[model samples]
Target: MTGNLWTAREIAQQPDVWRTLATSLDADKPRIDAFLAPLLAKEDLRIVLTGAGTSAFAGQILAPGLSRTLRRRIDAVATTDLVSNPREYLAEDVPTLLVSFARSGDSPESLAAVELAEEVLSECHHLVLTCNPDGQLYRNTAGEHSLALLMPEGTNDRGFAMTSSVTSMMLAALTVLGANPDVTLLADVAADALPDLAKRARVLAEDGADRFVYLGSGPLTGLARESALKLLELTAGRVVSYFDSSLGFRHGPKSVLNPATVALVYLSNDPYTRRYDLDIARELRADLPEGQVITIGCRDDAEEETWSFPGLGHLPDATVAPVLLLAAQHVALATSRALGLDPDNPFPGHEVNRVVKGVTIHALDE
Candidate 1:
């Protein structure tokens, strides 16, 4: 934790937190199943995964895979969209499940979106995943229609950027949605590889690169988005960051590459998606400087410079996301320190905030 202080500790503590999350998951299974079984049985159920900021990205990361697993209409709609334009997204006839992700669970958008859903949709059930037990979203979300899941203690990150909070929520969503991945193995692999990953990120962050691009495919795309935001937040806007799907990058966004730019490709485990991810990594390597293109995770990584996840290639992209995310977190933390900023509170002037301020949540009817 010496390198980035509180941010580092939060990042380093993730694997353990993941393990604890898994251990407690079994105790929740019966209750979770009781709540979800009937809702999922409804063929017309429209599941909307949501939150604000990093919490929203957690839903984005889980939506694709969860939809595939559940074979239902699932969407990752941010609470920001729901609050600002409720009528456009909500339908009264749809039997909807609003899965909200929140760290403190108190973000104005978090509860407002849930309230909007309750008001607008004729049949809306809530599944609240939050890190804080006492936060509004968890404390009294919905007496019966809502089933609130609390993440492990200490996941309420003290850092400006979310490290464990978002990931923990993603894992909870994955398990509840029936991915039921081997959490122990994922946690074990992360614990084993995190030290070296941290070192690699520290060196890379200190390399003076002013621009970073993260590319991935499918569920990995959400990971790329989260990675981009982490760098931007930790560096306090001194460094520019962008994220797009691997194939989507070729459609004009590739212009961001330069000598001072580094591209990180989150290789997917899905065979088809991995092809595009690897292709972009190779294309960027030839286009940018020799060491500027780096691949994170998976088997094909041997062909390119990579920050490997030794035992993780066999898992689904959904399971590997949080583990692979450690690299991005460390990179942001190191980048913040290298630029002489504080990771714990990147915007000390309140130009931005850990818990965002000044938002005025208005009545949807008005």
Candidate 2:
């Protein structure tokens, strides 16, 4: 392992990466603000937040909040879907704004989706958020009618899983979408809280379980899916994991609950959403085997291993929940390493690079 590479162990200790990514927002804020001004000013705007896998989830975590904050029509559409079925997702009349988040920006779906949007939509603008400056998405946007924001160096995680890159991109999206009441303050809070968060995650990961379930409501549900996949990917399928909405789980998915399983419930600060999450948590605590439930939230009053975001009020929106997801990723990374797996390259034979593989872009006649 190089000095710059992050072992699962090192990732657990370096909470400062979270802080560094958060604090860097101040410097990037003006640029993001200027880039987004024209898009935000338009009332006829339809924003699409997109990417593949974890990058796709970044949009999921931000879209609901961005929609509410910007008071504009915004949707989290997967690049995979946009690439395969462009007509279903790409509408013609609206002035579209596509926000693409990618760690490497070279993923076939990532780049292809951008090209598809430009080719299919009449009026479309782009905001490319990526860590690699040389990434295809970043390079292609140069001098074009698009805005590109590159994350801090080293954010391009060497690991198969995305940690800092995911959180940083989420933060950048939130900042650009106008969610922060005080950008500096929110960034400071995230920066200060990360170290302690990582420490706690390490402890949790050490206490192993055979299976894991991640639950959330609204936009957080999508985040729950991403979190579950992270553990699954990093562990190379050693740990069986699943994700669903709090209410949706009870329909049939709750049957997977057992003494050997760990259930992670993401509670919302909004009463409407929290009521459903808490109800499920309470039920899980009562019916499931003891010591199987772990709850994470921004509130102070949950019974289980509750994670809180003090000094932060009820966001009433899932947009803010992405900030809290950093801890969860830390836990997953630590757990993967605890199981004796190499976090950097979980699947040696998979042949999937940071960019991706097995894709050929088709040429379109002008």
Candidate 3:
């Protein structure tokens, strides 16, 4: 464990934490099935995955892939959005299952989202996945219509950014929602890949880029957002960070590239999407010849410009996203050190918080 900087240690320990969460969830399958069976059996059921910030990105990462696997509609709506305009995102007639993913379980929007769902929808159920058992969402949201799932110990990260907590919650959602969720294979990949990934991130961080851009396609786009946020949070906004879909990058965001910028592209395993990602990577390389463009994927012939994930060929984007997230977390931590910022508390003046503050929930007029 690194002294003072718990972020690096927490990020490095995520693979094992994910494994523990998988095992725990697997053991509780009967209960999970019982809670979800009725809601799933409903012919017209709608599922909304909600959270704040990185937790919200967990839903964003899972919704696209999980929808394909579950053969149902699963939408990712942020708690911030739901809190402000519950009428817009939440339906009154539809039987909805609001899956809440919270790291601390204490975020105001977490509880408010659940309350708003109860008020707006005739039939609503909750599948609360959080790191903190003591959190309001975990304590109050469980009942006949809801079930709360807690991650294994030590996942409640104490740092300014979420490393293990978000990944664990994301993996738990996959295990519970996936059709043939193979936790063992996902856990195995994380354990085997993280050591080298951390090293790669350290080397990249040592290279010292002033601007960072992370690009991904499909489900990886949400991960790009999370990765960019990690850098922005850990560096205390010192490193200018940006993220978008690889295709969307070419529109206008590509201007962020410079000699001191690090362009990281997360290549999709799907051949069709990978084409676009590769095309953009080449363009980024050509556009900023002096800047560093690192491709993170399992490309067989990656040349000299990639951080390859060997033996992880053809893994679904959902499974591979978590590993890439680990790579991003390491990069954020290293970049924080490069800029002489504290990974634990980047801003001593209390600009940002582990849990956001100063938000007052108002009545949503029916």
Candidate 4:
């Protein structure tokens, strides 16, 4: 309960930050329209959402929903992958719009991916979504074919893990890419859910669950990845974590479950997807009753064990995913505090970094 705990403040302030992002985007709608209108109109335009680490996960969360809404090919490729193998993902003949999501925007992969795209693609446009306006990706991407949108101030999280930063960038991408652009609604639902969610998370953290598994369906699977990373990062690797699709968990990943495990399931609001999520949760409860199982959903009655957000049932999986994001963050923060680690800089030895360091970028031609 310290104001100096940047991670806790960043996590708690997300609802309001989300609202402010919505309002700011609304005010700049005309500019957004101008920026996107022509690019969207292009025939066979390939939209590639690229980033590293937590930022890369944003693309994974948004691509499926955005591709469906826009009726175009939108792919989520990690900048790490793109940087390593530019020739595989980028094409010179095809027009490309690379949307880069970065918190600090200075990661080696961020700029390297852009450079590789320029080298290989004849026609390339960049849409940079970053929390830091002054970071390299934002400052250097101003040109005829590139536009960088910085998240409202304070989203650039000072914490070791990206709590507010990733969620805000994901929301910004959702807003601009036309995938359920109701930020106000998402923020409202998140606000409504946080009080009860925080209480549940604290109990879970204090309950001595040292192993965690996060499961989700479709776009929520991206959330699963982020959730796992948040716990791992915040706990400074003290907590072993895994993420998988709800159904996929049984294939092999379920072996991670035990008396010490906490299974966090993010259920999709979609009727079809919810079935798989519920089934997995039920199976986990039946098989590993000693392990704690937590399922988050929008419906009031799916199974006996679920955290229901009844007001948010009407929102799509992509829109409602952010609500569950807060739940995972709270859990991670609580666990970090429980473990007596500084969530702000969980790894002081610099094995990982706030902005990555010590990577030697190689020439693609070499």
Q: Best candidate per TM-score, number?
A: 1
lDDT of 4 by residue, 169-237 (tens): 888888888875677777877888788878888888888778999999889999999899999999988
**Candidate with the greatest lDDT versus the true structure:** 1
Residue 351 CA displacement from its true place in model 2, Å = 4.6
For 236-280, candidate 2 gives per-residue lDDT tens digits of: 888999999999998999888877788888887777777898888
**lDDT for each residue of candidate 3 in 1-366, tens digit (9 for 90 to 100):** 444368877877876787788778878999999888878888799999999999999899989898887888889999999999998897547999999999889889998999989998888889999999888888897579989999988888988899889888888888787545555666676777777876777788887777989999989999999999999999999889999999999898878777778888999888898889889998888877554888888655655337876556567787667777878888898888877888998988999999999899998884
Deviating ranges (above 4 Å) for candidate 4: 1-4, 300-305
Clash tally, candidates in order = 0, 0, 0, 0
lDDT score, candidate 3? 0.85
In model 1, the runs with Cα more than 4 Å from the true position are 1-4
Clash-forming residue pairs, model 4: none
- Work out how many backbone clashes candidate 2 has: 0
Model 1: worst 10 consecutive residues (lDDT sum): 297-306
N/CA/C clash count, model 3: 0
Q: Candidate 3 vs candidate 4: which has greater lDDT?
A: 4
> Candidate 3: which pairs clash?
none
lDDT of 4 at 85: 86
lDDT of each: 0.87, 0.77, 0.85, 0.86
lDDT, candidate 4, at 306: 62
Clashing pairs in 1: none
